[model samples]
Target: MLALFAVSLLWAFSFGLIKGELTGIPPALVAFIRLGFCFILFMPLALMAKKYRPNLRLVLLGSIQFGVMYLAYIASYQYLPGYLVAVFTIFTPLYVMLFDALLTKRFNAVLLLPVLLSILATAIIVFKMPDSGQVLTGFAILQLANLAFAFGQVAYKHYSVTLDSPHKVNMASMYLGAMLLTALAALPQTIGSDIVISQRQWAVLVYLGLIASGLGFFLWNLGARQVSAPLLAIMNNAYVPLAVLLALTLFNENADITRLAVGGGLIIISLYWAQQITQRLENKVD
Candidate 1:
């Protein structure tokens, strides 16, 4: 959970960078560059894991989680407002629990409360009915992204638990998979476009790729390995309010301070409630 919260802080600044600095850049290229940087930064360190032997299944899983998921997330913006995108993401916690249960063959009805609280809290913060004709299309696109992300989280958590390999090794190989797919997807768009990135944009990409994608994801997945799926799901929503607060502070964006405060408080409360209930259930089992 702490790992996820750390990534939330790292990612909060990213919203402003993408909106302010890299607004006109092609989404695919942006995705590609981010993964490319991650791959470059970690591939060398991955060599230390050469003795562990790379798993093909894990690599493919990483491709889906990081590569395809990013593609869908970046594409959804074409049809949805930023708020709608954020609102749509509230469903991700539910998806995480559902997918985690399905994959692991264990069901916990109690997980629903945390998921519900997360959605409600996030909805309070970001919900606004879209007036656009393509609202449904955008919602669908965002859900696809959400499911992909949820699936990845569950899959990686399950996979990592079974492995004796180091986290850095797995991250290095996983990022390689992401880089390959993103590069392939972005190549056509980047080849001909005269998308000349200014120095400022380049700097933004470097920060996003190095700090955000590289370190942020490493810490998040590391945290995922330690927490329950419900906790992971709740923490997933942490970025919403954090991003909103950061936007207000750094970008001078107008937001409901009261709503932000209340919503964030609810999320924190939801986390605590989840931990308590989960501990009680574990004790019962023991």
Candidate 2:
């Protein structure tokens, strides 16, 4: 849970940063750079940990989770504003719950409460009716990204329980998979384009790659492994309100303070409710 909260804070500024800093860059190239940096950062740890052989399952998981997710996520920014990108991600918690249920082959009705509350809370903060075809297109693309991300979270949580290796080793392998996919995706785009990244943009990419993508994702998955599915689902949306607040403050984006206050309060309540439910469930199992 600490890990999740830390990453949420770290990621709070990413939506705005990506939209603001990397506006003219190719989305695939941006993803490639970010994942590339992450792979470079983690591969050394994977190498030094001799006992940790790259797992094929983790590789595929990375391809879908980080690679595909980044591809769609960054692309959506082309069509939607940064805040709307955050808003559309409200569906991710629902996807997380759905994917977890599908994977586990059982549904916990009790767990649904927190997921619904989280969704409601986020909707209050960021939801808006799409007024353009492009907005709807962005929403659809963002949902695909959400599905990939949610499935990855649930899959990693279940799979990590069986592993004895450290999170760094596992993360390195996943980043390798992500790099391969994103590199391929970027190849065609890089062939003829005059990809000129300003110094400021380069700074943003470096921070995003190293801090946000590399460290943030590592902590998030690490935290996911420690918590229950319901808690994980709720935590998925924990960044929405924060992202909105950051956008308003840092990017000068307009937002209703009343909605941010009321919605953020509900999100906190939902998180607390999920935590209590998870503890009780664990106690019963024990």
Top TM-score prediction, candidate number: 1
6 Cα displacement, candidate 2 (Å): 0.7
Quote each prediction's TM-score. 0.96, 0.95
| Candidate 2 local lDDT, 161-186, one digit each (tens) | 89888899999988988989999999
Q: lDDT per prediction?
A: 0.86, 0.88
Q: Which 10 consecutive residues of model 1 have the lowest summed lDDT?
A: 48-57
Cα lDDT over the full model 2: 0.88
State the weakest 10-residue window (summed lDDT) of model 2: 14-23
- Model 1 Cα lDDT, one tens digit per residue, 1-286: 6788889888887877777678888888999999899988887787766575666776787788888888988899999888787888889899899988898899888878877997899888887878788888988888888887788878999988788778888888788888889889998988877988999989989999989999988898899999988899998898999999998988899999888988999998999988998899899999
Count the clashes in each prediction. Answer: 0, 0
In candidate 2, which residue pairs clash?
none
Question: What is the overall TM-score of model 1 with all chains considered together?
Answer: 0.96
Off-target runs (Cα >4 Å) in candidate 2 are none
